[model samples]
Target: MRKSLAVLVSGYALAGLAHAMAPAAPEPDAPRTAPQAYAGLGVGLVDYSGGGSKASPKLFGGYEFTNKLALEAGGIDFKKGYGLYIAVKPTVPLTEKLSVYGKVGVAKSRREILPIAALPAAPLVRKNDTGAYGAFGLQYSITPNTVVTAEYERFGKKKESGAKEDVWTLALKFFF
Candidate 1:
């Protein structure tokens, strides 16, 4: 009876130890959250259709309403002109750190042309135009609040001179 009692106590202790050593069950998935609003500045080289490329600068800001949708506004100096644009950006995430997006928007552009040295009699020309624009880009998140992008954008033809423009840019953005 004494030996049986000792064996039973030892078995109970070992069972309790096993229970304590077991891994806990996995927790349920957490709810998803959208990114916060952000603002950024970008500078890049703009390639003009008519000739050479030039340095371009931009200021932009936006809010992400969801993981896939956002609204943005920006001002850009596109070499020969300057424009203000508002766009809807729809994004598709390929991974936690990478995404592709499309931009569709309208812009108001103002262009100024100075008289050429060969044409002394030519006056300075100023024109204002409004048009639709589109862009597609790949954004790679470098951190929670910073991203880098490579994009191609096209602007509609100028109403006055029937000129169109395109640019390829690499940009860095920081989110607030």
Candidate 2:
């Protein structure tokens, strides 16, 4: 599931890139949308390849360079630790009020497992790693400055030792 999600996101991003870079006939007087900043809070379930699933919260902020392009940075709670990421978001509008987007970037994460109460003799376990991150999501506009989003994000899918993670969320995003 993780591998296939990666492939799908990678393929979509590549295709978007190819289309963006290709020359095209200029449209007549397309209105330029100004760059905007946005922030969001998400609540959802987080699943780990090692640890069990748990409810989690995520916080994110970004600057959209255009209606179709943005740079975003966000953090997610992992109970034992946390994950942070920065990604380039490319979006495709499906309608006047809906869009699909993909995020591709780097994530730095760390997880620490404390000795269990039943195993006081055991040592604490710590894992730190930096890896690729990807996400795919949909957005539906509620007002000019507000939208609701549903997303699935993955972190450190090919890690050598640390836990791999997934987050599924429904969130509210506000633009300023």
TM-score to native of every candidate shown: 0.72, 0.74
lDDT of 1 by residue, 1-176 (tens): 99999999999999999989998643332211556687877875665544556778888888888768889888778666786778999989888788899999987777766567699899878777778978899998887678898887766564433124565667777766
Clashing pairs in 1: none
Candidate No. with top TM-score: 2
Stretches of candidate 1 exceeding 4 Å from the true structure: 1-32, 48-51, 116-118, 158-164
Best by lDDT: 2
**Number of backbone-clashing residue pairs for each candidate, in the order shown:** 0, 0
RMSDs, each prediction?
12.2, 18.5
Cα TM-score of candidate 2: 0.74
Write one digit per residue (lDDT tens) for candidate 2, span 1-176: 99999999999999999999998843433322679999999986876555567778889999999989999999988777889999999999888788999999998888776667799999878888788999999998887778899999888755443345677878899988
